[model samples]
Target: MTQPPPPPPNQPPDPQGGFGAPTPQQPEPGYGYPQQQQQQQQPTEPGYGYPQGAPPVPQPPVPPQQPPYGYPTQPQQPQQPQQYGYPAQPQQPQPYGGYQQPQQPPYGYPTQPQQPPYGYPTQPQQPYGGYQQPALTPSAPGGGKLSAQLQIVIAAVVAVAVIIGVGIWYAGSGGDGKDDEAKGTGGTTQGATGGGGNGAGGIGGGGKEKPPANTQAKMAFQVPQPKVPDVTDVSGSWITDKAYVKPGVNSIVAYDLDKGTPLWTLPLTGQVCGASRHVSADNKVPILFEATKRVAPRYYQQCTEIGLVDLNTGKLVWSTSITGGSAGDQKARFSEVTLSGTTVAAGGTDGGAAFDLANGNPRWKPQVNDENCYDMGYGGGAGLVAVRKCGPYSSQYVLVQNLNPTTGAPVSQYKMPTGVKYASVVSTKPLVVAADVGETAGDGSGISDFFSLDEKTGKLKAKITADADQYAARCRSTRVEACSQALVGNGRLYVPTEEHEGSSGEYGDETNEVIAFDLTTGRTVPEKADAGDKYTLVPLRMDGGNLIAYKAPPYDKGGQIVSIDGGTMKSTVLLENPADKSVRDAETSFSLNGAELAYEGGRFFLSETLVSKAREGDDRNYLIVSFAAGH
Candidate 1:
């Protein structure tokens, strides 16, 4: 689906206007004290009117009077002298004319009515050599006045202590409160969105370290074998820490990836031809296209039905029938189904139809007369794409159209280059990369060319003459397809190449090379080595900044899965296929349907098919093996 435009840049307002400006910093809470009241100034001494007269007489010295209230006064002599080695007690002060005398202590050692020395409060005398109590001011009842610098220091200490305590509590409770809540509600640590703009519910493409090569493979889960007429297709999609699998033609099951327990299952009455998971901002559901036949006495017919079901509950949210006709009418059935945003589309020979995933109501269905329009599949997050042929079998011109994901209408259309009957879409966003397929050369070699198109206007951006013959020769003896698969990632299109071997047909040789083309410049990237002899690595999918690949040597058996550093091209084996015979056979069958490696929540998954032979008969079983990273 067309991705929503990015939010506008957040720009701070101009200082001149003062609009959207940041608020002035306020004093930290609990660190600031109320402004000190201004001290009152004493009235200026009255000017002497007789300044010019004779000097005043000198005054006599007088004994000091009792200090004012709240101020410490000098200590008075004891009432009586004490003997040697014995402490002397000072006499109590007389009550002031207006103020009440301080209360006496109940713990004996009579309260000293006499004021102690300045900066020191009266306290009971300590024993000889004992620890002495520190002197304290008696300016105020609650606390004494402190200097401004001292107050700042005290505030800083208190602020630091509070911060440390909060940090400890946060660490103990979990780093992020939202993440803790998600975990409690069964959310995974891996990113919800998958690579290739595939959407949210699939296996996450974010960086997930693979398991060690020596780690053992264990079955994480398996669905009970369901009896069906035939197993048309088997596929799996990741939903949080669980996997949703269409294990059989008439059954879809969800299993917990870690515990291997079945969560739910929905049995079907017809064969599912196409299935995909729609992942939006708030919801994820499986959309299935099934063809069911009804055998009535006079009417034997089949109809195509599209449905949406909850992933966790297996409840049918909504379903609608698309086409109803004779069972043998091929043109009346939808051959493929895909999801984009809130729209689910199914394409077939006549044309294609779309329905709103939210409510299962028909959105639109474009009609193309006498031409087969097939769904080319999702262009990542760009939108849905389809190819329409103009002429009959003898001669035809291929037309490519970018369909509006919301309305099922063509946004742009362009005629492909002459002589190419089909194009394989590699990406659909900022740039569209496709490989045009043409007839094989007279020398029995394949012919293919890569093209880049502008996503907005469907105009040709660039073209690269692919060396299909060289690639075919390299994989001639291997089970891997000779046709190069184009993978776009990190602003470059990776094109398979056999440049190292050239045109040589050396026996037992394998190809492990890919030429990267800069998307913006349309030039080959020479900084990266196009080939390596250390391992037979075939790029599968992009995992964050790294490229996940499969070691292709042991094609008939379980092989090593490695991750290639995107910048250095260094290969590290992440997982190895089990040495068991059943696993080997299963890997062979699994490889027939492209690569089976998937990463989700720091774990890797490989879906395999196991065949069990028994006295009664042989049964085919499907099992998904999970390999946790660092295990």
Candidate 2:
């Protein structure tokens, strides 16, 4: 949703400013942490992140979501899952000491009075493992130092903790699954993601877009949202040297990167359901779409077509589909798509298939078997990995397999820990997986720990325990490569901490920071990028060794695109959007959960992936809103 800078250590907490300032919360339970909240369940069979108490309706299996801020300006729809996007699992309110009202959506709900605007804010106390020791903020201005006796007591406690930690590591190495508690050199290594953007030394090298002379951007053009009767999915966006590409109702369209005018449009017979983020060296991507649009009675068309689109030419080079298994003669329908090197792959409940990226040549077809171990999904970036699920629907575990892109065979396989219903692949080469072991992250954020494994050997290197409340990184429960705000590069796993009270200001500001964990040591590095007060930072993607991030604006400001040094965590604003009121309101309206963002060549684009019919009198809904600096 955004980008951020570190503030001075000690400042007064503002009683105002920032979006969605959360009141202090009682420590919450996560993946492996102890539960302090209680709940209830329905008698119906459970599906991944299914609506808790609703009448059952057929839908795709989706991940859970933590509480998300809704659109205040747009008309308020019922608090239900849209036809697209993840579903928020129902949580029963637990009895506390006092009565608690149900949570409210942002639109139409009465907002609390506005507080004064604050400046720089403080860092959030990072949560360690699950214990959540109090993060000691710097003493407020002029605060006195600790006394000598107190210092000595703190030292003794630290010494005892070190000794106990070492004992746990030793005992954990001996098995009994206690190893889950130990820190890890996650993934053991890191490699460049397979696009030309990862130039040597992590520079956005290779004639890639360079920072503009003036980083301030004025309003460019926007793609208006097409009205849809039902919630629709246009969930893909990308950029190249010449154009910005997006998928619309039943076509893939490209627009002039600077002018925002249409470059060309490639028409298709049906709607686009999914697309691969990785663009091949030739500027081609494989997208999954339905064979035809709704034709009444059979309103929901199956996603049965895979078409390779040439971004440079805006043409559909070839299209293909497979048929077998349960569907018999009907083409197989897939829910996911990814790319690695020269191979394009698609996976789903029906089966999985791989095709040559250059031509529609089948490399492999679904094999008949009773193993029940299907490749549920694959992650593509620096490497190709598959999350293979086995056992019956009642009880199933997964295997993370590093696959040969062309052969579809496992080069190395790592067994995920027990009791993990689903695992999200964060990276493939260094091979990191995120999961909520035993459903410990009960708030529906979908992750509590990150497992770093050796991609070549499939051996475990380290396990990183991150509290769901403390970190904002999320990987959709089953969609590999569906991770937002979680970035990996430079041999490190980077994540933004959840927003907290800022360091200084008349009205305390809300802010967050980006921190790195060593991919080899599973230890945190000193590098961190703070989201300055009044804005929030979300990791967009990596630019060579540097990180490309978006700085989500507050009420009065437009968004920003920043480039951060991987080693120093120093952020350079590459593109600062207009601060004008109209533009700022338009830019901030897109929700973080449903928005698709891309920044390249001084152009920053924010688009809504899920759209529905807007009510009369409401501001125009946007499909793609853009800004360009030095264009």
Candidate 3:
């Protein structure tokens, strides 16, 4: 037998395994079909199973068929084999013009039709003239490996997108975009770990325990006196670093707290009737009412001057003179003046006046009705001036109004309780109105009621009633009658009281007590008095949750400073002032020569006037002392 010849170039090999076997009929042109094989020639050389010079077997001729549409008559050139095996069978042109492998088996074995890979097409594919297949990517078990540079770029893009999203969220959430440290005043600095330190002081009646009392006199300084004679009254405001002194009948001077140096002095051309400190954010000034005596034939006349002097520079900012009859008759001479923000309001029995603080121009004329008398003053922390109008008869109602700080217009107005003749504002933040509630007794003593109003709407919050006899007595000794001896702190009002003696004609038989009332519920706090404590505990102010009180003597003598716990009512002496001969001599000559206590920041201040024995004729000097420990 002879070996088979190789197939013609550009033609496919037979799919059938038999020698010189006829192939099946193919489909017409343009239809998808496998390429046909050409006739093979006999082998010239001998093969392993065949001898030489064997007769050649004739192959049957294939019928002529037209070529597929759009294809040339000649067959295409065969491509190189992808793998080392028998010559590859010609493939049909795919629909996208890519080639597909033939459906044929290896030599000598029965031919079995090929199946496409799973998920691929089983039928023959058609030609698609300009289409190309995408190249397959090399991959591992999971997926293809990415380049290092591409991975870094993807991570950077994702991180940037996250940062942008976070930035947008933070801006929408009320971030002020300022450093936290730059937003505070730094005034109330607290201690490191202690609970009852400066800034650690809580409000609303809840706070930490009081610290141990180590209030020995830490230091002392003197506020120098003006050389003028007849120094009538001296008062101090610890909110500012200055003290006010009224010397003689016409001069008011302000002195520095640290060095006893005079800062400014206001000399009135007329006799000074009354003066007060008007505190504002931009400037602190003294408001004065002065009366100049004008002598006319047979009758004496007088004119009043209302003036404001800058405390820092001693400059007379503004002054206006009003003839006695034009301003408020004789009542204008004694009108109460109060400062709230940039408005200055003066109200009296006759009328009232509101002035702009910037230039002292009149904002509005005083409202005076013949049947009612009005009194105006500061409303404390609510940034308002209270105008209280009382009727002529005690049976009529009293009207109260809280005026706007800048406009002097009534923001809220309400009538006093029945049978109340007078109402005055005591505190402003938790607005407290103090008024005489009922008729006086035979001894001229009465009951005073304190009503706490809502700061914004002036609605009543709480009401507490207290005895007015001791309050009246305490106010009579002070220069300013409107100054509330009752201290408001830690959500309680601490009022000084005295037990009235029976009808036995005994003046020195009264015992003093300080009562604390809760502002929220208007109930008395259940606290016991300090054991064996005889002296009156007069509360001046609150330091944290503790009360800074003065132990007043029964007679006109010296006193000591003490700290009273708000929760326990325990008393601890902070300063001890002996009633020696020198102090008694000073008190005998100068009635105002006693210890005055003030506290600011974290330090305690005490101002005392001592008689100068070296000088003649009632000469006195002032001494200011400070006490600061664990501040």
Candidate 4:
């Protein structure tokens, strides 16, 4: 690697958006669809948010500005467990094109929900093209009616809705979710297995589970939301054959996959800050949490504790913290964590560290001797990778390193192109990285182009330039391991295109497609996964060499899980959720881009990474919602 010109003041790479700043609120779900009485709808793309062959849709008057998304100075006293809010989430990722940027409140502050955003049209806007639904029926015949397969599915949904009555899905009936209700994790593997996308970014893997005879699902169980004085971060979640593990308050709780009840509760001292996206072979994961709970004026604590949790047995097999040079003997803090090979690594503005995944012994501590350079962060899973920044802050460049997990040494290193402010490790094994060169990604997604590199030799393979407005992938500005919404597998990168008008321009028909890019050639693949109309498809993870995606529900339909074959891109619907209003309401409550979602053994799990204090009229805010189908 070239060592460029030298000698200037050194500073860490800075990305846009200061930590803890308030972001805007989101549009509401469930708008009504306008009907066309006489004429047939035709495919049109002349303009966005417009119906074909109809007069321009009237835009509503802009609403009042919403408050920021952090907690107030005076926190609200939460109500009893039985009286939480239901589905009316105040702050979420914006609809249409908002990127799911990572936003954490400053140390002690919780997010305070602001007033509602601008009112949407009474009739929801339709967004899509006339692409045929992949893995299912062909496109709509003439009018805007749904496909034959969808019609049948709707009928089946109604039948099941009558049988189940949406009664089981609501939070009111579920237990209050007290800590005592937990069935302790036996400290054993429990025959569990890691369930996640490939080494890339995704949370769940359903490749091994066979499609049920009736793919439609019924409500399995839901974990009710707990009261927080303010917005709290509980960002980690994982799935195994036996239990679905989620971090709550300062504890990690594993709940039975079939029953919403807790399997075991592993308590922690501080609140959970970060979780490993990749799970170990034996169902273990590394986590970063605070050293102590927030109190009085000292609102927040450094995310100083790094620990490995045995997911199967609910045991904190090992927990420890280390001190850095002048950065302080006061315990090093980390912004993110990952697991690779036999190592667990943590990275942040405070340098980086690694530990043996098996026993939690320190592999290395943060080094501050090199004032001109620092380890910005590391990404792991399939392999361990790091982004090291050096040179003066003015002309600093980054080296993306493929590391030897055991020694914390770079096996190979690639120098990033000049003028790159920050870089994120999308996947370590495939050696995919993303950056907003010249800060061109104005959408706050913190990505502009993807660099496919040679991990073994530290060479450039391909550079896939992504247009922020055109692509919907996200990576938090300075967190090296936080890129998401983009799936990498089968030597291809899958991302959703922006939503557009669908065939028969009608209200509420927005749609999009998942297109693939060859990592080897940096060229677009011919096959695409279309979300049909009215529904938007987001690629979740890869399953069995296929793409697992979530189909966002339209005004009257429920979400569907479809598998797109890697070779042909032909999609197959694996689970079709009920469109019944109550069920749809609960399912949509978990925002599409912001929610933590996964599927295992035919069970679909939706979870929240953060929660806040409920206002006076809040109903039953649920923390986790589960849907399952089987023989």
The clash count of every prediction, one per candidate, is 0, 27, 5, 23
List the candidate 4 regions with Cα displacement exceeding 4 Å. Answer: 1-209
Off by over 4 Å in 2: 1-158, 164-210, 296-298, 505-508
- For model 1, how does the per-residue alpha-carbon lDDT over 478-519 read when each residue is reduced to its tens digit? 001122245566655654443232122333333346445544
Q: How far out, in Å, is residue 216 in model 2?
A: 1.0
TM-score of each model, in listed order: 0.54, 0.72, 0.52, 0.68
Tens digit of lDDT per residue, candidate 4, span 1-631? Answer: 1111121122112221111101111231221232212122222222111123544323223222221112111223653332221211111111111334355321111123222111111333222221232334324667566877887786566545433321111111001111011000101011111121122333223365467899988888878888777778878789987999999988999998878888899889989988999998889899998988877554577888999999989999999997663356677778889998898888766667788887888787665543345667788888888787654554555667677777765566665654465789888878888876556566777776777776776545556667665677788757788776788877777778766656546654567678776665454544566788677778887776678888877757778888876555667888988878788778877766567878776888889877877777755477999888745
Clashing pairs in 3: 94-126, 95-126, 95-128, 205-490, 352-366
**lDDT digits (tens) for residues 1-631 of candidate 3:** 0112332222223121111101111221231222222233323322112234646433223222222222222334654433211101111111100011122221112222222221112354333231234534434357976677776675567545543321110000001111110000101001111122121344323333233454443333344343433323333332354553332335555555554455666677754444444466645553545455322342222324566766556667887643221243332433455676677655443345556778877665443333343443345343664544433342334445555555544455444544444456565555665654443211222224565555544444345544333332122111112444566666666666543322232444333455565554444444423312234455676666677766544344445566677655667666644355454333223222134556543345555322122445534444444434331
Model 3 segments beyond 4 Å from truth?
Answer: 1-214, 218-248, 256-264, 281-283, 291-303, 321-334, 368-381, 390-396, 441-447, 468-481, 499-511, 528-532, 542-546, 553-558, 563-574, 584-631
Tens-place lDDT digits, model 2, residues 171-252 = 0110111112223321101121211212324533222446799988987788888877776778888888888899887888
Ranking 1 against 4 by TM-score, winner: 4
Root-mean-square deviation of Cα positions for candidate 2 versus the true structure, in angstroms = 17.0
Error of 4 at 553 (Å): 0.8
Q: Could you tell me which residue pairs clash in candidate 1?
A: none
lDDT comparing candidate 1 with the true structure: 0.41
Winner on TM-score (2 vs 3): 2
Better of 1 and 3 by TM-score: 1
Instruction: Indicate which candidate wins on TM-score.
Output: 2
